[model samples]
Target: MKKILLFLLAISSPILSISQNSTTSQIDETFKAYTGWFVDAIFYEIPFSDTFQIPWVLIVLIGGAVFFTIYFKLINFTGFLTAIQVVRGKYEDIEKHGVDNLYGEDAIVEDILKANQEDELNVAGDQTPGGDNIETIRDESADGEVSHFQALTAALSATVGLGNIAGVAVALSIGGPGATFWMIVAGLLGMASKFAECTLGVKYRDVGADGTVYGGPMYYLTKGLKEKGAGGLGKVLAVLFAIFVVGGSFGGGNMFQANQAAAQFTKLFELTGENSGLYFGIVMAALVAVVIIGGIKRIASVTEKVVPFMAGIYVLAALVILFANFSLIDDAFGLIFEGAFSGLGIAGGLIGVMIQGIRRGAFSNEAGVGSAAIAHSAVRTKYPASEGIVALLEPFVDTVVICTMTALVIIITNFNGQFMEYGVEIKEGVELTAVAFDSVIPHFSIVLTIAVILFAFSTMISWSYYGMQGWKFLFGKGKITDLVYKVLFLLFVIVGASISLGAVIDFSDAMIFAMVVPNIIGVVMLSPIVKKELTKYMNAIKKKEIAIEEGAGDLNDQL
Candidate 1:
């Protein structure tokens, strides 16, 4: 504890000193290089300098999703019911049955026997349990630190944050309402991509002998691809992914969060003015820094509490706007369709709207960006495919459902002319959303402010995990190594808030899109293995392969 306090003091002192003094030209020059890249990528290049035309990366994202959706024969659709049952504990008896009333020593012997037998079958069947299988994690840490729900929540904590709130707003701003159509299409198709990547995430995970579990695209790209005879390429991709994941953690995951929060504050109370944003950013950075030091458990604990509360509150607010404008709901939707296919102008074509929808949707959910793979990698499942099934729901919840609600609110609120002229301009994304929400609930900006802060906080925590995983991959997995990377992350949050490095932000965006090139290669090459893993897990569930422990076993217990 003393060490942590000292560290915090060391970090915070620099911020206070810097703020108290006049700004340095050196700081400006340094800031220019970093933030400049970020802006260029997100704003100018995504649609290739146009009315939100599709980028190559997005095409790959959508194409890969569509291919896999068909290849899996719509596993996202057909397997939903089964996935629900599994998560709901319908297969609890499939693992351990007679152990509850067994003699103590005998139970241990029986468990050994069960493990030995399963190992033989697993090897013969070519089943790659990796680190995610329930047996894999449970046997390693019989009493794990997290519950299944907690693990799900931790994963949710990461997935369900900014991507839902501000990301959707950004998509609509650039891609327009037509993008909403493609966003849903991308979300549905993305189910297959999520399933595949997560399966690999579990398949390639590495657990320490101490029961510390590690998993993500880095492991899978390095290990899974190597096993499929792409050792050299895998190494290069793994390294590149590590670099980009670290970049992503800072930009899309953390600083953008602080930047947005700062904007919200400055906009609301005029509280921050210019200096207010920087100080506000420091507070956010500190909040993130404190929890991140505690690692996954701390992040999970906080997110489990924060995500549901924030989501429920935000969704309820959207509900009020929807019902309050009950009559306009239909008309609002009609406008969405009309704008979605506004083919009379701008290329006079169907292609324009199609491009807008797909680009906006893909950007919003991050389906093919491969970011979700980082979070899903840590799930407690023996079958790699199990997590894959769960992951498919991400895009559905994020873009399909949540983004739809935000759009509806914005469209419905426009009925009373709360916004300008009923069409969006380049500069009006946040304002558009703010006007819509404040229309119904006065002082609603307070709620929106809190929601944005929570969204930024949750996103930063989750992105920290993703970036750390990548850092460990490149710099060796050690505590000191992790700490070094984290300090840099915290520093970036403050820096992001203080400057206007739109270009650096753009560069980060490009890096995120660049990640798909290597990731998709690994997924496509090893798809057959994914299929095999899926089959073994399904068969085990079907056969009810229970561990008949001759000791204290509970078949009624959850998996």
Candidate 2:
């Protein structure tokens, strides 16, 4: 790890020199000149009529989500309680013992008995049960790395960042309060999309020789589609998804996060200097490097702690502002509902409002974008659908809960129309959100700044793992490949912080959303497989309940 860090610094020194020679503004202009066309091309909107244009990517994301919701019989709603139970370890015994063991399958039962017999011998005096013979016993839950809760947090860390804080502000500003209503609707529908892809992520995952799990759209698109006799198509989609993920991880995941965190931190502290960003970048990069170098287990461990803490702080702050303006709570919801359908002040009326809400919600939660599936695939579970069920909660938490909190705060604060004008796009979304927070609570922008930094830090570490997985898929997995990816990732953090490259960030954002194309296509194609896995997991849960009930009856009779 020391050598790797040294190598990263060594490689980044030249780029750092180049950035130093040119002013930050110069770099921004140069990057925009070079990448403007790419950004425009990727974000090209499809026109249904002269007055209405929608980005094709948003169409794919929302359409896929709606399809999944209906096809799964609204699993998002029906499976909500079950998802909580799974994360809480309600089905741990079934997951650990394998479904076959619950039905008293002779082969599995015999292995358990044999393992117990071997434990009785203890010839080598190994006190641990089964000792050297333990490998003979199959633990169904041992395949993956992290627990269901850890994977949820890791994925949540990636999605619940700047988008909830800044992006929601932008959406509500343009579409008025109506956008918030549609955003929640989009979030609820998106739950099914997350369930489908994550299930496939686990179903078609590749477990390495050393038991490291490699799973995501890349794996499932290739392996899942091949099972359905579309190997050629699957391989192409997988490669495309992998390339997009790596690019997205670098720009949107790593650099953009560092850049925003640095901006918010420096501005709040009144640190105005050419090198302030560079200095903050180094510190931020160093902190991120420590967490990411430990790989997924370390990443998961850090995120499970950071995500909850940061989210709790941000949510609590929002709650304070909400309760303070309790009188306006009804009015805020009234605006949201009225604006959603009436679209009185928004451009293009109801269509414009619906588009803004759905677009922001889809982008925020990233439900069908396929990135969350990469993180969810790492969960330790024998039943793929168990993790998939848990994954449905991500969009709910990110968009429905957190984003809603942000919107309500913005709406209630804007009752006097002092902060922003309706129907106008707000460029400085973070600042606008901060103003809303600071209005009711004195000096609350300081807390908002801290939350932004935490959001950026947690986001960077999780995305590092996502990008590395894609890197390994393209280049063979090895120590060198891992080192190279990490070095580049860390370097991007500095570059992102030191320079403001709007065009570059826009391109990366496009790459991130571009992922929706291949992912939605592949997941829809493999929906049947997800359904089968869901059925298999549900049956196991039912069987476990029946067994428990029968045992209780026998004990009652004896008593």
Task: Give the winner by TM-score.
Answer: 2
Error at 463, model 1, angstroms: 0.6
Tens-digit lDDT track for model 1 on 1-559? 4444554465345445444545455443444454555445534434444444556676777888888898888987987777677556555343223222222334354565566467566666756552333323333323233433445556656556555665556555544555567667877887788889878887788876645557777888889878878889999988888778877777777777788777777777776466776788789889998888876667767887987788788889999989888998888777667767773343414566566567666766676666777666666555667667777776777778877888788767765554544224345356567667888988787888888788778888878988888878876777777887788898888877776544445556676777787888778887898899888767765444343332334444422
> Model 2, 1-559: lDDT tens per residue?
5544564475345445446546656666666655577678778899988767999888889999999999999999999999999998888656655755644434254565555466555635766642433212222235777889999999999999999999999998899999999999999999999999999998888887555778899999999899999999999999899888988998999889999999999999999998999999999999999998888888898999999999999999999999999999999999999999999978979999999999999999999989999998988778999999999999999999999999999999999899898899989899999999999888999999999999999999999988998888887678988988988899899888988866668878988988999999999999999999999999988876776676622111111
Clashes of 2: 0
TM-score, one value per model: 0.81, 0.91
Best by lDDT: 2
Query: RMSD, model 2, all Cα superposed?
Result: 4.8
TM-score of the candidate numbered 2? 0.91
* Model 1 misplacement above 4 A: 1-52, 92-148, 173-176, 272-274, 342-349, 416-424, 545-554
